[model samples]
Target: MGLSPVLWQFLVHWLHASALFPAEASGIAPYVDALYFFLVAMTIFGTTFVAILLLVFSVRYRREKNPVATQIEGSTLLEATWTIIPLAIFLVTFVWGALLYFRIYDPPTNAMNIYIVGKQWMWKAEHPGGQHEINALHVPTGKPIQLTMISQDVFHSFSIPDFRIKREVIPGRYSTVWFEATQVGTYHLFCTQYCGTQHSGMIGEVTVMTPGDYKKWLEQSNSGQSLAQNGERLFASMGCNSCHNGTAAARGPSLAGVYGSKLTLTDGRQILVDDAYLRNAILNPSEHVTAGFAPIMPTYQGQISEDGLIDLVEFIKNMQSNYRVQQTLVTATSGEAAPTTPSEGTTETVKP
Candidate 1:
């Protein structure tokens, strides 16, 4: 009991994190600290052992001690021992690190989802309940929260020191990171990458609260609808329903039950329907042309905002798990039937 405080002080000092970053407030923090401490201890021991050997050899084998030089011969046993021991230690380190890497990257199925978009100098986080926060995220303790992140402009890294987790948000692609807060407190959020002129100011805070408090916080900020609900409205406004109405004669393939499923592309390559693939198919329909469909859809690169795109993706992902499309669409916002135009009926298709 008496040594507890001293050990705690030593650990805090050795990590060099306790002063700046908060105490371990995440499930993975302790594990990360353990691995880091182990490596540091090994390094210190190796350095001290080598220094001691050098000093002892210099004094014991000095010129005056023997007055005669003797030929030194290599010992195979000693050489083998040194080589094998280091190799074993390295292998152990590798395996331990690999397991931890997977555990950190691969989120559990029960984890909650949060979408984050990184721009030039700020972070945008969106919750399922339609709560939006800029540069600040609120989450509950004890529940796993998975962050699906992407960059809107230059590359940015989302780092939280207290959580011992960081992930790069790159443009044109998605990156994911997850953590479970073990304590309720505020932690620092930083963009480790130097993004732009205001990179230093690109900082935020993660407010972790008790489960009850988190629920209340969300309720207070909830926008009265879900992301998927908003996406459904946006999808209608975009005139996608005119082609992807999920009918027999509909030009586009049915999106129901298509997410996470495999489908072949027009280029004879099979690909899984994921968030990245869906986003690309929507923005660059011609490039990701469907197998049977003609490549006639125009690009929507500038038409839809990033937030709109995210909502649409969520809608498609949650649409018809057991197969459901509440209503069929015939007209876009223009209220004109697109399929009736027999000539040059080329349009966007979200096939498979």
Candidate 2:
């Protein structure tokens, strides 16, 4: 069956252009569509109205018809109508756009977090399941996913046009963006900021799949250690356990419950401890020292790689609630003995 005449006409007349070809797959897409179409319609109307008036006045007041040039002051009613109408339109779009902006920037509670590292020529994504991908992202449809992105070098922008979300990936600082996909499909992911020579090649796909399919894909990858587990390993190996593990001789504060908490710095300024704060604490310890703590931690700016730093951050995040380290002993299907972290309130038991 074909679409109804009215529906077909609406599609053809309103959305057949390039502005509407991209499907709305995220919560913010509809807002973008409305703002875009409203501007397009206004532009068309203004152009047509001005063109018609010019043509009519040129013929009506031509030198052959009216020899004397009539000079007159402008009409207050016409002037007020045009000025107030455009001002009102501008104000409405501005307010509407601001609301949509906040909706995209605010991360919802319980949203799955993903870390992204944008280098000179590629986009690297680190999932909590220890699955890492270069130039690609896999997410479950209909779930809100929050991305913490930072650049390894210059400024870069992570953008998904279909989702109508884009944010700057700044170097040495973290920026975040969030979106909830409504459809299951593959969409284009691009770096809108020009980094260097291979900027054009820094494009990839975001695959949105069903929850079941995403789970299957994670299992198939067989990543022995979760992101937090790997981070924990890195944490222990790097001697971070010496000071941050709640010891009397330790100089740094215990990071166990620091994530998402408001921290008071030595300078009397309070800051929220988020992904960016953690990253900075590791890379530049002197920047924001916690109150009552000496700045003894060495800066790891060039010593640690981006992936390693991400793992460290994840480990810190998981420490908030004694996060389980899911280590598969044998394949779940085969039922072999694999080492796994003890769940909260559960005793560790080993099978022969």
Any residue pairs clashing in model 1, and if so which? none
- Please give, for residues 167-284, the per-residue lDDT of candidate 2 as tens digits: 9999878899999998899999999998889999999999988999988988886577788777876776686755564433455677877999999999999999988789889998
After the best TM-score superposition of candidate 1, give how far the Cα of residue 99 lies from its true spot, in angstroms: 0.9
Model 2 off-target regions past 4 Å? 1-9, 12-20, 321-352
Q: Where does the lowest 10-residue lDDT sum fall in candidate 2?
A: 343-352
**Which lDDT tens digits does candidate 1 get at residues 124-161?**
99998899999999999999999999998899999998
lDDT of each: 0.83, 0.80
> What TM-score would every model get versus the actual structure?
0.86, 0.84
| Top-lDDT structure, candidate number | 1
Q: At residue 22, give the lDDT of candidate 1.
A: 53
